[model samples]
Target: MDEDNIQDDIRIYTERRWLRFSSGSYFPVYVLLAASYLLILIYFTIGLFKVFPCGPDTRQWEYFYGKCYYFSLETASWMQAKARCEEKLSQLVVINNTAEQNFIQTRTRNDRYWMGLTDRDREGTWRWVDGSDYNTGFMHWKPGEPNNDGHGEDCAHVWGNGEWNDVYCTYFCYYICEKPLPIRIKGHHNRALSVP
Candidate 1:
C-alpha cells in the first residue's frame, strides 16, 4: 500500500482499539468511584447522629452523674467559697441523696469541706446557695450536731467523716463546687452539643 493509505489505516486501527478498550472498562470504575463517595457520606451522616457524650472540659473539674465537681485546693470562708464558685459559674456542692453524699465523702480525704447548706437566713430554716429549701432534701448531720453551739454556728460543712455540721461561716475550709451538665437532647435537629 502507498504511504498515505498506510497512515490512514493506522489511524483507523488506533481509533477502533481505543473505542473497544474504553466502552466497557470505564463503567465499573465509575460505579466504584460513586460507591466510594456514597460510603464516605454514610460515614459522616452516622457520625453526625451520634450524641457525643457530655462531660467536664477542664482538667481541674471531675465529671460524675451528669455534673461537674471541683474540689478547691485552697481553703476559703463559706462566703469566699461561694464567691469563688460563682466566679467559675458553679455553686457549692449540694447533696441531694445518700449516693451523692457518699460520693462527696469519698473525695473528702477525711478533711472538712464546706457544703452548700446553711441556716444563715433564719437560723432554723436551712437553705442551699441556689435558694433551694434544705429541709426538703437529704441531710447528713453528725450525731447531736448542728446544735448551733453557743448559738454561733450557722454555715454548714461536711465533717471528715462525711457527716454534716454547722459551723461559723467565717471559718476557713476547703470547699467543693458543683455545676450541672448542659442538657443534651437526642434528635436529628439537636445533634450539636456543648459540653462543659
Candidate 2:
C-alpha cells in the first residue's frame, strides 16, 4: 500500500538521522564538552594547590594583588621590624612595581614607613630583603635622595608622599610586612586567628 511505503520512508529517515548523530556529530560534541570541562576544573584546582587560603592571623591584614600585607601599628628599628615580620611568617614589604608602590602610598600618605630595602651589605648596591634584584625592580626615590647621608644611612624608608630615602637602620619607624602565600599542607596551622 502507498500508506505502508510512506510509513517505511519516514522510519528510514528517522533511522538515518539518529545513526548519523550517534556515530558522527554527537560524539565530537560530547568529546569537546568533556575536554572543556576538564580544562576548567584543572585551572581552578591549580589555584587551590598553589595558594594558601587566607586565615585568622591575617584577619587585619590588607589584601592586594593576591597577597596579604600588614602595616605596623608601632615604630621599630629596621632589624626589629624585619624580625617582627618573620615572627608573623612574613617579610618586610617589597614594592615591585608602580602599582604596588601606589597601593602602599595610599597607606603611607601622611606617615613614614619602613620598607624592605637596605644597602648595608654593599653600599650603593640596594637590595630587597627577599633577595630580589633592585636594579631590575621598581624604584621611586625622592629627588637627590638615598645620598647615604652622614655615611651611615643604609636602610630605606618611604616618605609621606611615597618617595624613598636612605636612613639609618637603627631609626625607629612604622613598617610594613608582606605575607608569603604558599601551598597549604595537610595538618598545617597558624596562630589562632581572631576575627573582628
> For residues 54-163, could you state the per-residue lDDT of candidate 2 as single tens digits?
55445567777866788999999999999998887888999999989999999776688999999999889999998899998899999998898776999999985899
Instruction: Tell me each candidate's RMSD, in Å, in order.
Output: 6.5, 10.1
Clashing residue pairs for model 2: none
| Model 2 worst lDDT run, 10 consecutive residues | 187-196
Candidate 2, which segments miss by more than 4 Å at Cα?
Answer: 1-53, 182-196
Number of clashing pairs per prediction, in order: 0, 0
For candidate 2, report its TM-score.
0.66
User: How many residue pairs in model 2 have overlapping backbones?
Assistant: 0
lDDT of each: 0.82, 0.83
